[model samples]
Target: MPKSLHRRLLEKGWSEDEIERTMQMMYSDEKREKHAHFVSATHPVIYWVGLVVAIVGNLLVAVTLIPFLMILNSTQLYVILGIVGFVFGSMFNLIIKDIEHVDQTHHIVAGVFIPAIALITVYIMVSVANRFNEVINNPNPHNAIVLSAVYLITFSAPYFVYKIKDFVWERKQKASEGA
Candidate 1:
């Protein structure tokens, strides 16, 4: 059986009258039924892959601190990461919404995955940057604070953007009351 709409309606607390009315309205138009098929829309692989790419590409903060030519100190490099984080966080917020297949689990998955990758990258970053550290004989510091910030700020960004989006949206249901 596909499913029983009547039973489903009863389970959902819809009164008999409401269920009948809703069923009548939904099935009344044969043209509308033809437009919506039962196969379900499946997206291409790349469409799904793009979400991964966007998350990975956006959270590449350690990359800024990894360049050989850019001779800024670790502190300066950390600042650069912050600047990049803001831009990337915003981009991530935008990209996740645009992607069709992404969900809360995807963000939650990234919550763990991005930081794990980030930790490894930061280790590499500190190692690479430490090569230029002649004045202060500092060993490899993982900068856990920065990494935790990466963990929190990166995935939480979309939610913050979503909240702000809510604040900015205006409903046009009613005309101007102030004449």
Candidate 2:
């Protein structure tokens, strides 16, 4: 496929800002929707409710899933949690995305907050439930925190990958404009 005009201009060292200005002048009558999130709703309240439900769902999943699986095998418990985290993370990511311009503030906050709370609750529940087990007979917050990190990483991995891609794209656009 042929390179876009913007790409051609950039390759020839035209500043991104100039191309954007020129494009705007050429297509001044066109209207553009600023938000890129895939959610169909236009109201902010719907997104807030989705975010809240996703958080609750994540917590419910983690709270029940971890200890139940921990019984089957203590060694790979964190691994199992991480896998589950990844699934929940992806689902929550979609739920968190919506039509409210962009979740700039919520992205960093809610994105992590949902999974983190779930994992933390899992840690607490596990420690409490395994009070009789020799390994966790003396349950420690430090160990739970460490184990929770495994879940946290996998859960947020999918979401963060998209966020990182956006970040890099933004930086590239900024650098192109600067040049």
Candidate 3:
């Protein structure tokens, strides 16, 4: 069975009165039910748009970095894989949200998806750039290795941003609860 409206609201951080009113509306109006269905269908369009933006951004980053990298012939492979992964992540996020029970796992799934795609994209682009830099100056493998490590750290930028946003929202929820 579907979860009760009260439970869904509590999970969503809605006020008690808001929950009651929503539940009442759900029961009393067929129109409200239709609207809910519409919202449910369209809500993740925003996420899809975000994913598309991410894909485009990652592709741009890749294209920009490719020419600059003077490194070994293998840099192209990694860059291509990075682009593919981001595209897959975007499409996966869009498709998964359409399936039933997606609401139960949406946030965690999205949280993981965004960072994974962002990290892979960043790593590939930075790796190529680092190799390119090293190839022009020193033929040393050590520079490439160091660049990889630094690039991995940079790849985590999105995760930190996501965590901060989540923390702020949680704090707001607690403050609202206290008031």
Most accurate candidate by TM-score: 2
lDDT of 2 at 100: 21
For candidate 1, give the lDDT of residue 27: 77
What lDDT does model 3 reach? Answer: 0.58
Which lDDT tens digits does candidate 1 get at residues 1-179? Answer: 76698998898899999998888888777746665543223333433575567546744555555552146554664566655666655665565554424456655564455445555555555555556453355444345456446544654566577866655553322234332
Order of the predicted models by lDDT, top scorer first: 2, 3, 1
Q: Return the TM-score for each candidate structure.
A: 0.46, 0.59, 0.44
For residue 1, what is the lDDT in candidate 3?
96
User: How far off is residue 108 in model 3, in Å?
Assistant: 2.2
Global lDDT scores for all candidate models: 0.56, 0.69, 0.58
Q: Using alpha carbons, what is the TM-score of model 2?
A: 0.59
lDDT of 2 by residue, 71-176 (tens): 6455567677778878888887676665224656755677667776777776776665565355665432225666677777888788778778879999999999
TM-score: the better of candidates 1 and 3: 1
Tens-digit lDDT string for candidate 3 (122-165): 56765666676676774523234433434434444434554577
Looking at candidate 1, what is the lDDT of residue 179? Answer: 28
lDDT of 3 at 89: 51
RMSD of 2: 10.7
Model 1 residue 143 lDDT score: 51
